[model samples]
Each structure stands twice: as structure tokens, then as C-alpha cells.
Target: MSMFLVRSFDDPKGYIELNRPDGTLPRTSSESYVPWGVSTHGKIVYAKTGEHTGWRGGTGQHRLRPYDTTVSQNRRRQCQSELGVMILNNPSFTAKAVSKVSNAMRLYLQSQDAATAMACIYKQIGHYFYTGGRFGFGRISESKKDDIGVDGVWRGIMQALLLGRLDQKMSIHDAIGRKVLPVLKGGQLVKYTNLATVVRQDWFDDPTRRGRVNAPVRAPVTTKGGISKLDTPAGGTVAQGRNRGVDMFSRDLHRTRDKDADAYYDDADARNLLFGAGISGTTGTLLQAGIAFGKLTAAEDLKQYTLAIIGYLVGGGMHSYHETMAVASKVGVPYNPGAFETSMPESFRRSGLYTAWRANFYDIVVLGATHWRNNSGYLPSHLNKELTSPA
Candidate 1:
């Protein structure tokens, strides 16, 4: 059957030119003037390389062709409207969307000193893209078990809630709007769309630039007094009284993979760091393991994140080596040599195994707070809900 996407096509001669503005067109004698050298002679026909060279923009791939006028125009309009829709529907549209959620999470944290706004925002981003403002995770195409409790875009809601509730308001908007708009609009609130437009036009070419929302990693506490109850202890390590629970939890997560001490810990340091002392208990181990494994089973979240990034394409959610590390951080787990690098066998990375593992992980521990909130509410029921609802 023919797809509805066909309606979005516009001009047949307006093929997407992939070259830089000033770049030369391939087959046009490399002199740089034949920018539109590659043209589609007929509707739906692929562009053929002509004698004149057409240079590509930016990457210089030189794959320019004339798009079908009708198809190109329709697609262009649809894209613009869709982009606007995306901006308007973004979760962080208003202050309360961020503030209410962030505040909810702040109650559990001890201190907000040096808290990062970006980290909080990022946690929610995965949710935003995955849910696509629809709420439910829907049918996950792939499976992973390491994604914690989040299956879609709302995954980052926890971080946002935690950070937003802190003393400082964590805004994911531009500085200019932050300064001028408050007064410009006579104290009326601005939206993510407003801020994103500025960001898209100026500061960053890619809205989803990593480190754009820089989340600072807290320094590890060394002194005994500074340890949290979350930490579990180990033997033979002079760093006694260290609460290594989080670390220990990460190490012994996959019990089936390693019922033995050596299997539980990937390295001697991790094992020695958590062995012995009154700290290790069966109950504690079970509870901690449950939580850790919960984070590891992110199959659904992996599927959702992958789908979101692919569907959005141009939004700031592009894949990065750092995202895996970010997820590890959220779970309070440490990343090893294999998380970001292509070290894992292609079979492991590409196969549905990782995603399946992550999905289960998300289902157990982290609650899909944002997904539930947005989807189950009166959101889809009322257009005026945006006015009545906090977000």
C-alpha cells in the first residue's frame, strides 16, 4: 500500500542538496559554479550524475538533485509545521513543567550545592523523544535490560525533578531569552520553542549537542565521615568505613553471570573493596542487587531511545559516545572500558540483546514518572489543558 508520507512531497526539482552553500557542484567542471548540477529529470526518478559536477554542501558529498516540485514543497511545509509542533509540544515548555517535576525529586536529595541543570534536563530528554509527547512507551521494537525504570522519553524526569526542586531553577533555555524575555513579555513566561529557535539559529547547529547541558560529576568522597549510607564496604582495603554500596551494587549486579566473588567483581579492586566486614548481608545484597539489576534491564528504554533519535533526526537527541556513560551515571553505576568504545562484539551491540536487557532494567527500578504523568492525564483530551496544566 502507498504511504501517507507521499502527500508531504513537494517540488520534484527541489531535491535535498547536501552540499555547502559555497561548495562546487560535482560534474560541473569543479569550478564551483554548478551548484545544482545534479537534477532529477522526472518525478520519483533518482538523480543521475551528469557531465557537470555538483559539489555538496558542508560535507561536500556532491549528491544534489532536483526534487519533484510538488513533493519538495509539500515536504518542506510539513517539515516546518512539524518542527513548530515539536517545539510547542516539548515537555520543558514552561517553568512549572521543569520546576514542579524537579522539585518533586529534590525532596530525597541531601544537598543541591553545585547541582547541574543540564543533567536533569538530559534525563528527561530520553523520555521526550521516546514518548514523543504521546505518554505511553508503545510497542518497543527492540529490547535491552540496562535502562533502569524508564522505557521512553520520560526517563530523565527523575533528574529534572531532582534538580529543578533545588534552590536554583534549572532552565533549559537560552541566556538571551532568560534575560530579555521576562521583561519583554511583561513578565509572561516563555517556551522551549522560543529558546530552541535561538539555540538552533545561533549557539549550536545541533539542538541536542552533548555537553550543551553540562552535568558535573560529583567528586568521590574519601573521608569516612563523608560516606553515604548507600555505600557498601569491603575487606583488606584501608579505606574502611567507606560506604561502597552503590559501587558494590554495580559490581555484583549480574549474579547469574558471576555467583562467585570473582564473577561478581570484574576486578580485584572492586572485590577487595566490598568484601568482609558487617556491611555485606544477604538481605542487603538482595535489595541492592534488585535495584542494580533493575537499572541494567533497559530493553524497552533502549528501543525507545533509538527510535526517538532516529525519528527526530535533527533534534538534539543524536547518538553520542557519552550517552551510555550518562545512563550509567544516572544508575549510580560506573562505566567500564566497553560501554562507549566499540569494544563489544558487533553481535552484542547490534543484536537485540543489549536493548532487551536495558528494557527489563528500566521496568524494575526507575519509575516512568513523566511518561505516566503526560499520557494518563487530561493532556490528549483537552487542547486547553496546556493552559490549565502546569506544563
Candidate 2:
């Protein structure tokens, strides 16, 4: 979210004005460099605070927050606030993935001779990444491991480490800022790691169920002289989308104007992350369905499932279900949208199993069915009662 003013030492042109509330105006002075420890950059030009156009001074701004200087209380506050959020957001698949594996263990212990443990384990694992965190039996109070941790923690950590390879694949913009800028500015501008890229790494690889970054790329640039020269030979960063992990799913898919046009999956990694955190295999699926519905599902399916799930979850009656079905039949695609709108019920839709199927290939087919229903003027009132009524 931090905006930076970028300029090359080699440029011969005049000053560039930043668009602010007042108007676009040139920046003047800049301060001596100091490192922002959050990135690899050894230093930053501290832009001075207060909005002023043109070259008033060379000092750059340093972000600061005024606070009471009580040492003991502040220490505790920092640990509880800043450190707590950091741990939660640090993208540790180990802690989370273990939670799901542990849940599978607990279910195995409880079921005894009744169920297949491996299937339960796989389903739980899939559910966790899709949902991003755990729910139901996966809830913190009900978690199986208590505080001991899962047996598979080491393996989970290894997988997270392996996926970190994607983090090393720099975006064209990032490489320009980090690797290229150092040499360009006579080494004065300094190379700093982009926070957006770091956050994107966490956001993209996160198995924590429902998370996604949907913002469009604000600026685009072709690589500079030597960089472009080398990139052409190296098979450069020519892909679409902001994050490499996110862009992986976009291959061969039709591009959309929407920010997350190509992020669809049969099951998302976010589910696994959550399941690892102790959410139920089932609950994770339901939450992933909501997120996937918003970001990844087809448009026609969006209209149908939004109405259907919202109606069911909100305690609307058979009549509401009927109305939802009516709209869905008219609007949803039949075959390509996933499962049949006729097959979805208030209880079943919230149950997690149904939503899991929807996240896969079923929803696409169902979207096609919805188009057919819309064209045929089908009334789904009777069908809703027949399918959704307690069986």
C-alpha cells in the first residue's frame, strides 16, 4: 500500500508530480538513506512528511506512529498485538497442515472399524486448504492435538519449504526494483524488496481456505535495456497475473476482465491450510465454496448458488428455497456449472460435502444447466420441496 516515487539517475527530464488530493506536483528534497528492515534493501530515501508540491526539500517520509512511552506495558502490547498477527499471517503450513492431519487421526481413532482412515485423511487435507482454517470438530476448543502437534508436522513443513521455490520467481516489476535498480542509480537508489511481492508469496501459496488477492496490477512496464536483452535469451517473465502461484492456473484459460479470472481449481490449497489448522474437513469445504463462488465460479453459477446458499444459511423456508430454485433454474448453467441446482438443498448445501463437489468440475456443468433452465421458463417450486425436504 506504500506509494513510492521512482526515478533513474540517468534521466535527463524534469520532475514528475505525484497525484494526491491537492494535485500532481513534483517532489523536492530527499533525506539520507536508512534501511527499512522489512525488505532486503540496505537503505531508503526518507521522504519528508506533509503534502507539498515541487522541490521543497530533499527529505523523504518515514512512517511513524505516536504512542505512550510506558516501557513494560508497551512491551506486552507489542508482543500481543504485532507478534500475534505476524505469527498468524506468516504462512506456516506446518502448524496448519498438522491440524488437519491430526483431525484425520482423531476421526480414525473414533471410527474404529467403521471407516477408511486414508480417505478421511485425504478429504480432511483437501478441505483444510480450500477453507483456509478449521471449523466444527476442527474448532480450536475441539482440536485433536490439543498442544502436542501432529505427527506429520515435519513433512508438512517440508512441503511448505518446497513451495517456497515459487517465491524466488520474481515478477518483472519486482526484478526491476530489486536486482536492476541497484546498478542503475550508481548504487545510490538502493535495491529494496517489494512488500507486495512478499505478501503475494504468502497470499498465493497459502492453503488457508478462503484467502485471495483480487486487485489489478496498477502499473505495467517492459523490461529495461540490459534486463530485456538478457530476458529474451532466458525466456523471461512473460506470464499474465500478479503472483506466479496464482498465474499457474491461468494456462490455456480464456482471460477475463476480472482480477481473479483464472484462479479456479477443483480444490484450492487454502482448504488444506485451514484443515491443518484444525477445521473440520466438512466445514472447510463449505467456506471454500463461498470464496471460490465469489472468485472462481462462472457468472451464471454465481447468481444461482449465491441465492441458494444465502437463502439456506439465513434460515429462509422451503418457500425461499423454492424461490432460489426458480431463479437458479432460470439463470444457472446446467451441465458445465457443476452439480444440478435441483440437487442442492438447504441442509445438503451447508453440509460441506455438496459444496466440495461444487468447487470441482460439477459447478461448471450446473452453470450450463442454469442457462437451459432460464431459457425454458422452468418453475422449480415442486422440485425444491422434493429434493430438499428431509429424507
Candidate 3:
């Protein structure tokens, strides 16, 4: 939600006014840079991120289940938020591909039992890399929100670390910002992104009626870049629409849109990411379900099963930690290193999982789904109160 002064709306010289705002603007500035550290933040981790425009998601999504009430994608903010959302999400335009050679290794090491314990220990990192039709990583609580396949803690961990590689792949904006760039004066994560590539030309088409940079009252920018848009993938509005996570059987699918909220997601590559995520998340749930049913063939050996279960927990925990450092990946936002601290482990500390994934974390991860059920929290108290409260 940070902003730069465009000098004059009537005739922008392309140079932003550099004087700091006098406590007037929303503190969304990424210009200032500092070495981010966990100690700087207390118990609750916080990652300051800004929207970037650069993505290839402009298609109709139908495969994954949606919520009862749909969300409006109509973007109406003041500043230009993204050069393009894809710019921040998909960075370098890398295609997601299932590694052929690695599959050979996977097959060689594949487990024939109803469940594969080896997976608890071995994950092919190179298998991801924005390949396999997979794309950008999702936000903190995005996975559970995307599909209704019951992505509990263990399953979420499996999905994030195993099959669902796109959550951390296919982003150049993140790579350059986290790895290539260093934190500068005011904790700014990114320096230059060459955003002109995706800047909507029409916004500047009419030289006379240009979009104001920081108007006195509200956002005047005519593009998607600006203040935070309403009901992000993590917002309360959209989150509540899905009844937290209770409306699992709801046949509706969360549709994808362009930065301008245009219908998209019909291309082969785009579909890859969508279906890839769906399948990945679904696969993890199925595995968890199988485990609940005692489907592991190795359990007959008692020793192996105990060892496998132990490995699953330990390895999953480590994977969750690894995600915190997955810069240019899903866990941490690009350019903003503090985002890592904000990252909640895949199996724990997810977006509002205290309700969405909490019970499952215990039932599945700890107790092996003794009380198996998917509950994303239908009647979220906070959401209900907000809705009924005096506006």
C-alpha cells in the first residue's frame, strides 16, 4: 500500500517526488531497506508486503471446488498496486514441469504399499522449479482456501513439500529481490523490477487525464496498482464467504482473474498451475485418508511403520521451516525478507488455521485422524460479529 508522488497528475515526468510523507500515507513503503531479523518482531511474525502486477492468471477456474457466495474481483483502489500481479507472483516466466529424470529416481525409490513412507524423508526439490505446469506459490492461508479437499496439517505439509511444488516455483521477481538484492536504507526489499514491461499503456493514453499519484482524499490511479484491493485471497470478506471452510460440498469454484479482474486461466501453462495445485493438495489429503485407514503395507512390520511415522513428523516439521526460507517461493514474499518470519510452517501456524486446520492437526498429524472430518470453520465468530456489528 506504499506510494510515490507522481509530481503532477496533469503531466507526469516519470520521476517520483522523493520527499517522505509527513505521516499522511499508509506505511506501505518498500523503498526503505534494512536487514530483516526475527528478533525485531516479537512473538507474532509480521511480513510487510506490497502488491505487484505480473501474472498469467486470466481464465475461468472450474476444477477446484468454490464457496457458496462468490467474491467480487472488481479492483477499485487508489494507487497502482501491481506492475501486474504476475510480476510479483510469477517473476521470470518459468514453466512448471514434472521432472522426467527425477521421476526415474522417484520410481526407483517408490514405495509399493498403499502408502509411501519414503516420501516422508525424500522430496525432489528440482522436480519443482516452476516446472510441471506449476506456477507461483500461494499466500499464507491460500492452500486451504483454494480447494475443499481437506488439507489438514500433515496433508498440507505433504502438499507443500511433496506434490504441490508450484507454491514456491515460477517466480523471478522473488528470486531477484531476495537473493540478488540486498536490504538498503529503509528495509526495502526490492530496488528495480523494470515494471514498465507490464504497466498498462492505456492508463497513460490520454496525456491530459493522467491518474493522480497521491490525491488528497482517495486513490486516483486508474490501474490495478495502488492501495490494497478488497478481499484478497486472505481477506475476511472472501474468507467468510466460504464459511471459513465448512462449505466443503459447495460446488462453486474460486475463479481466477487478471489484475484488472478480467476472466482468465484458460491457457495450457495457467491450467497446469491450477490443476497442479488441485491435484497436489488432493493427493496429500488422500494419503492422509489412507493413513487413517491403516493402509500402509509396512505397518505389518510394526518397526517400519513406527519409524515411518516418526520420520513423517520430523521431516514435515523441517519442511515447514524450510518454507520460511523459500524466498521467491510461496512462504515468503519477494523483495521483503521479513516475510520469512511471517511464514507459518506448512503444518502449523497457517492463516486462521486455529479453526481451519487446528482440529485436523491434532486428529490427523498427532492422532492419525481418529476423528476425521474437514471443518474450515463455517460460523466464524469474528466474521459473524463483524457482519452483525454496527458499521
lDDT of 2 by residue, 282-350 (tens): 112222322221232454334433332322211111111221222233323232221244433343345
- Best-to-worst order by TM-score is 2, 1, 3
Tens digit per residue, CA lDDT, model 3, 1-391: 2122322222223113333333122233553211111111111111122221111111232111211111101111110122113222221221111122123223322323313322322231222232233321222233332232322322443343334323221121123122222321112221122221222223223222221122133322121211233334321111001111111111113222122211111221111111111111212221222222222323222222222211221111111111111111221122121111222222223234222322222211222111111112333223233222212
Give the alpha-carbon lDDT of every model. 0.25, 0.24, 0.21
Best by TM-score: 2
Worst 10 residues of 1 by lDDT: 1-10
Per-model TM values vs. the true structure: 0.18, 0.20, 0.18
lDDT of 1 by residue, 9-117 (tens): 2334334434333221223443221112222322222233241233332213322343322333222223222322232233232223333323423332223322333
Worst 10 residues of 3 by lDDT: 71-80
Q: Where does model 1 exceed 4 Å of error?
A: 3-296, 306-313, 317-391
RMSD of 1: 26.0
